[model samples]
Target: MRRTMTRLGTDTIRRLPKVLLHDHLDGGVRPATLLDLAAQAGYQGLPETDPERLRAWFTAPTSGDVVRTQEGHLARFTPVLDLLQTAPALSRVATECVQDLAEDGVVYAEVKVAPEQHTREGLTREQVVDAVLEGVRVGTAKARLFGRRIDVRLLLTAMRQAADSLEIADLAVRYRHDGVVGFDIAGPEAGYPPTRHISACEYIKRENFNLTLHAGEGFGLSSIWEAIQWCGADRLGQAVRIGDDIAVADDGSAKLGQLAAYVRDKRIPLELCPTSSVSTGAVRDISEHPVDVLRRLRFRVTVNTDNRLLDGTSMTGEFTRLVEAFDYGLDTLRWFTVNAMKSAFIGHDERLELIDGVIKPGYAGLSTEHVGAAFFRMEDSW
Candidate 1:
């Protein structure tokens, strides 16, 4: 067992073997890649052509406020999506996505892509899936040459407002053996509830496939309730609004509402992206983010970069924010990493291999002080 009193620094956090469960492929296109694709495809919708300015443009708020409506934030993906219409463009984006995650020290990632959005170019849904999978394969091979071990998988997402969820669900199942791992429903969670895709969810469940829903971000607890109870979501994406169901008394004691209690008790994973949550108005800012409360209460909390380009965030940045806000050290960081590994949509043996083999050892090797009994006790339990 390793006990450390030193806080997790940027370099250490970057080197940690992190697992991501709720990242979006369309929302994470590199600014340079977007510019190149736009040029190649003859699409000219980008606000800025210069790489630095374009990066700033994507990350900057729409109305000079850091917080925006979920719909407003989502609209920023239009340029990226426009360029990703062709198979080659899709492959390039997917390859670059994996390379970026690998460079950021992601050990395993399940990236979500909506096939329906890429069909305007006349590519069939199967062709779209195959292109992305090819990119994943190419990216993985390239990463291995550089000694970066990143295992990437796909999650096929259906737009909640659309009626093509069952189609998307079938596609996800069809490609389960060829890099696709799970199913998800994304987009405007308010009016288009998860129940709108209940048939898709049921099909996934009946097929024993994994499902994660974008709940409690754009909407409130009802959305989360439907996603979990009605739709049988395996994970909740940015479930920050769950804090609404919790109360803390003046004495500093806490009480959980029924939904929150059930969520915590079941060890349901909350894929909380702190910066993205702020951008989407899920919380006012990182300081008020519910991840700290959920983590303290022992809910299965995992930090993620919901969108690297849109949020201008990475796994390193996410952990750095948490460390600054909550004073979290290596132990806390290790706990979060381990929690994500345990909750991933991978096989049990593979999950255990990453935890015991990669994550724990990586954290144990970091430079730190010989913190005594308290740290050792935590290590024993872990």
Candidate 2:
């Protein structure tokens, strides 16, 4: 088993099978799409006049620092929200988002976006839901036509600082068959707790809808605890701050706090967005990411691009960052990719089909290409 695990082919990792459990539809808009949609909608608040400039603005460094700095912090989440205020605009962005993810080598992606944020143009919650679904349907069909297969699932989020979470939950359940997979709460995570939307959480639970809450990112373990124990979240988004509850002993051993032990033992899925986490200051750096510790400890760690445009990343980039930071070889990459596929918010049979039909075969084909020494080196202490 060890030899088989250690000898993962470079080609397999290069093909880099991936499943994204936590990307935001509004947050993942292609700059070109946003530009065209803004023009069609007669809105003129775009940061740049042209798509190339907008793309550069999205990916370029802010405040003069190239690597890590505070110059680009505000540009991360606010730009997407700024441009995605109208329903038609949101729909166009969401549709192109799938195309973008597919081009970036994501086989399956679940994009989360709050419907409430796009209603500035008098769009009802139902209208918002339908429009986003239409976009995903079109995008997925286009992907299949181009021989790049991917299943896009929409997860409706209720802004944490806002009311009417139950309304959003109802919208999610109503569109279950129309590409909507689950319900979530997203927004400023510091002050507005998940308990603020208890009714929505309750509705999701009663309706058997999937739930993933954004917790333990900027906040601490208390936020994570409430999302799981108080709200019954099936998965967690950016649950990086749970590292605070973990302790490393003097003799190279580790001890998990009560919350950490429960979360690890129960195998709760953590949708970790490495670049996004760093941009948001959720962790000190990529190398210090708790994902390595969590993965080695047998936790259900899933890789995601929380916001592609904001973080200037795709699934491939996130995987490459992990590989570089943790010395993760093909085995670890495959493990993480498969873990993401299993944790997707889809039915058992559908996920099985994707894994067997596309993911496994893709990796096997890549495995025959490269027989390198190793791509990354794992820490002995780890």
Q: Which one is best on TM-score? A: 1
User: Model 2, range 235-290, lDDT digits (tens) per residue?
Assistant: 99989988889887787578999999998888788999888888776667899888
The 10 consecutive residues of candidate 1 with the worst lDDT sum are 373-382
Stretches off by above 4 angstroms in model 1 are 1-6, 64-67, 367-382
Q: What lDDT score is found at residue 59 in candidate 1?
A: 91
lDDT of 1 at 31: 90
The best candidate in terms of lDDT:
1
TM-score of each: 0.96, 0.88
Q: What would the per-residue lDDT of candidate 1 be over residues 233-337, giving only the tens digit for each residue?
A: 989998889999999778867899999999999989999999999988878889999888888788999899988999999999999998888888777887888
After TM-score superposition, what is the CA distance of residue 93 in candidate 1 from its true location, in Å?
1.0
Candidate 2 worst ten-residue window by lDDT: 373-382
lDDT of 2 at 162: 90
Cα distance off (Å), candidate 1, residue 165: 0.1
